[model samples]
Target: MIRKIIHIDMDAFYASVEQLDFPELKGKPIAVGGGGDRGVVAAASYEARKFGVRSAMSGVLARKNCPELIFVKPRFQRYKEISQQIRTIFYEYTDYVEPLSLDEAFLDVTQNKMGNPSATLIAEEIRNKIWNQTQLTASAGISINKFLAKIASDFNKPNGQKTIKPAEILPFLESLEIKKFFGIGKKTADKMYHLGIFTGSDLKSKSQDFLEKHFGRSGLDYYHIVRGIHNSPVRPNRTIKSIGTERTFEENLSSEIFILEKLEYIVEDLSFRLKKQNVAGKTITLKIKYSDFVQQTRSHTVPYYLSDKELLLDIARNLLFQSKLKESVRLIGVSVSNLNSDQKKKPIAVQLRFDF
Candidate 1:
């Protein structure tokens, strides 16, 4: 049976929250993050985006692009509180809500409590409820599956909604640019462009064997997804297997001291996040990406849950030096898995419900 999926994404979530809380900041170009050299933008308001500012862009570059842009420190607690409120609204419709992050979620409403046959109307009502409750806006995409729904949500953004009907699915996909496919990234898109696969139609024309030969395992996914065959469910109650953070440096560092310094910051961030979630893990992973983009990972599993930053740093340092550096490193990451779920204040899954 064809499933009805809706992808709801809050437009500039963090920045929008800030604007809602502070009325004076509404029409201005605002960013949510540290406004320092090493800082990265967590969100950019539409005003800031008009100036080419975006999330994940370095604050230094964002400021260069929009000198008048205002940067507000992120308030994750406030964001989470609002996220929970929004999620409560989702549960009222259907418990098949799968949160991707604090700002976006996938809802399976094929058989909803309201018995609403129209997914588009459900999306509209959800958006209206969110705006009414939070004084914020969200964009929604409605389609037969998660992939199409996700792509459609971005079509008319910032308090708008779009629906990709069953009949239009194939045509909509055929005319789609390859870069817009959910799983396709910028680098992959570039490779596809060079390979004469500029659109979904181009991708559909390529044999599965041809795609696999070029993209390995992911090529198989591309082959099916382009043909409008993504069957991945909107799985609710997804468990968190791990928590981690990584950073790519502006310049490659060969000095071990410099690398260690960066590792300290990464460990600090990881520990704070773990503490915030009241979760800890036994396995520590160290991810390193060299200057040429070659990557390596080293993991050390301990008998006890590890949340201590100092200890984490020591373990990460050993993992780093244990592996001989092949070249200067461009990026580093630290993560922990084998999580202690008992410590969580609440279950990770959306509250389950069934339509009788």
Candidate 2:
């Protein structure tokens, strides 16, 4: 039995939401984030993307890429509200929905409540419902498994759908560029190119042992995914492993006094997140990124759970002063792990008939 998975991804979610709410922003290149020298692009509208503006790019560079790009502060609360509304539409079709983030998810509608057999039609209907309710467009991909579905979803993006029938899977995978595989990043792709693995067919030609020798444990994943074999199921209830927050400064700090000042706000933000989730952790970790891009972390575990801002700040301060400053620091982060929440039970996978 084969599973029918549909991957639904909202088109430039944050930027799109901004454009939807502000008519003036429509048909323009816009970025959703701070516009200052220290600011980072959280998301870029389609128009901005064409000019090489992208999420995580520095605002300075984004501006250089497209000077006319308008920057808007992010409204996370509003995005969450809209995300929830979109999720409700998904639940109407299937219960096996695994959310990747606020704007994308995977749904196993092999046995949908609507008694619908065609995952493609269900995807189309779901996209339609989202547009009708939120005035937002979503792209979807339907295939026999999550890996294929996820890649297919991006084939025709920003209000489009694609279906990869079982018979077409092998040919599609063979023709796909190695870099286009979901988990293969630039560095990995470069390494693969050096190894003559330029396409999925090239990747599929390598033996598991050869791949493992070169790429270690991840090599096995590459071998299987290249052949369109991904067995990971759609887990609807993913565990919250940690709650944290971080800030990158426009200017690096050289003194402990200035670093501590930044830690105060970082700890406060982490506390708010932990409290919002009604979860606390016994371990607190501090992350430091130097101006040169070198990173380090210091963690301390307490006997009792902690979520209060004062307590987190105390731990963060200790972690910070635990060692002398290596160099000018560019970013600082605080995270709490080892939460007290109960682990969710794993659902048993059911073999279902595929109609795609």
Candidate 3:
């Protein structure tokens, strides 16, 4: 049976939230993130998009491109709260909800408990509900599978919805450019262009073996994506392979005190999150980025998984002190991995729904 997959993504999520909270910022080109030399854009409003500003673009370049761009410091704490608010909204439709990030998630509503037969209409209702509850706009894509739905959501973004029925799959795929294909990064897309494979029709002509030989595992994915086939599920309650958070600074700094302040904040957030999820990790990783954009990470694993914030903070501070950077620090991120074994508690599958 054809699956009903819906991908819901917020429009310029961070920037939009900033605008909603600050009325004066509405209808203005805005970027959310630091505006200093070392900062990168975290989110760009629709008005900012007109000036070619985008997420992850250097803040210095963004200013050069859009002289009037407004930058706001990120409030990840608030973003996380809003994320949970939206998760509650998804549960109203179906249990097969898979969150992709803070502002987007996938819902497998093939058999919804709400008695709604049309996934497209369900997406419409969910979008409306999000707007009503959070005063934020969301775009949704409805399709037979996750891959198609994800692409469709991007088609009409910023408070929009797009549907890709199975019948329209071939034409849709044929008309797409090689650059837009999923998993085809900039480097890979350029390689495909050189190989004369620029569209679905071009990709369909190649055999699976030929694709695997050229693209490795991704080649097989590319071959099937063109045919509108992806068996990957909207994984729910996905194991926490890692739990961490990071933020870009407004300016490069060598101030250990200021960095420690930021680290403490993230540690608080991580501890609260892990405790809420009832999971702990044995490995701690410290990520650092320099003004020159060089990034480095250091990790240590312990014998026992622990959720102690004090332990994590102490080790993370030591890692930062040891990381000698040629340039001032531009960003810092923290993460914990090697989660505690699950043999102590009931399996997540059972705890999640209790179906069995």
Candidate 4:
């Protein structure tokens, strides 16, 4: 039987909430983030987006794009509260819900609580309920699997929804831009363009062997996705195996001081997240990716769980020095695993954002 999957994405979640709560901010260009020179934009209102302002862009750059852009500090607590309200509406339909982030999730409605049979109606109802309860709009995409549903949701965004019936999958995918396909980042897309694969149809022309030869294992994924085939299930009650953050610098860093500075930020973010979740782990893993794209990970397991920021930084520092760097470092990451059972079962999404 065909599965029914729906991807729900709150429209400009943080920015939208700001608008809804403060009518003065509505229809204006605004960004949710620190307004400092070193701070980054967490979210940008649609008005700000027109001027090329985007999330993760530096606040200074965002301001240059739209001098009128209003920067507001993030209110994670309020956002979390609203996220719960939205999740409650999702549960009214199905237990098989997978939250990708506080602002987006995937719901499996093939066998739902309402037994509605129609994923379209379920998405519609859920969006309606979210708007009614929170005065915020959401975009939804419905299809046979997670990938297509996620892509579809972005098609007509902001209070819009779309469904890709099984028969329509091929043509729909064939017309999509290669860059828009999930898992294909800007770097990958540039490579695809150079290979003359600009769209789904272009990608579909390559054989499995050809794709695998070019993209390694991920080539197989591209081959199937371009043909509208994704079998990954909507996993519910999914345990977060690990929580981590990583950054790829524009210029490779050879200086130890610079590397340690970056590690400090990564450790701070991880520590705050662990505290928010009220969880800790005994294992600390440090990952480094070189300028040549060679990746390596080193892990240390302590006797007791640790969540202290300073302690994590110390461990990361030791791991960094103990390992020999083959080349200049391009990216670095820190993760904690072997979490407590309570944290593993905790129903919350931990989002990892990486800029290419």
Which number leads on TM-score? Answer: 4
Which parts of model 1 have CA positions greater than 4 angstroms off?
Answer: 244-282, 289-295, 300-318, 340-356
Cand. 4 Cα-lDDT: 0.86
Model 4 Cα shift for residue 85 (angstroms): 1.2
Task: Rank by TM-score, highest first.
Answer: 4, 1, 2, 3
lDDT of each: 0.87, 0.88, 0.82, 0.86
Q: What is the TM-score of each candidate against the true structure?
A: 0.85, 0.80, 0.75, 0.85
Clashing pairs in 2: none
Error of 4 at 283 (Å): 4.0
- lDDT per residue for candidate 2 within 257-347, as digits (tens), equals 8888778767766774675456799999999999999999999999999998899999899999898879999999999999987676555
Q: Ten-residue segment with the worst summed lDDT in candidate 4?
A: 347-356
* Candidate 2: regions farther than 4 A off: 243-283, 286-297, 300-321, 324-355
In candidate 4, what are the lDDT values of residues 1-356, reduced to their tens digit? 57888999999999999998899999999998766755567789999999999976777899999999999977767888899899999999977789876789998887778968788998999999999999999999998888999999999987899999988999988988999998899889999999999999999999999999999999999989888788887776677667887888879999999998788777866775665455688899999999999999999999998888889989999999986788999999999998873643655433221110
lDDT for position 191 in model 2:
95
* lDDT winner between candidates 1 and 2: 2
Q: In model 4, which residue pairs have backbone atoms overlapping below 3 Å?
A: none
lDDT of 2 at 149: 93
Runs of candidate 3 with Cα error greater than 4 angstroms are 243-298, 301-336, 339-356
How high a TM-score does candidate 1 get? Answer: 0.85
Angstrom error at residue 179, model 1: 1.0
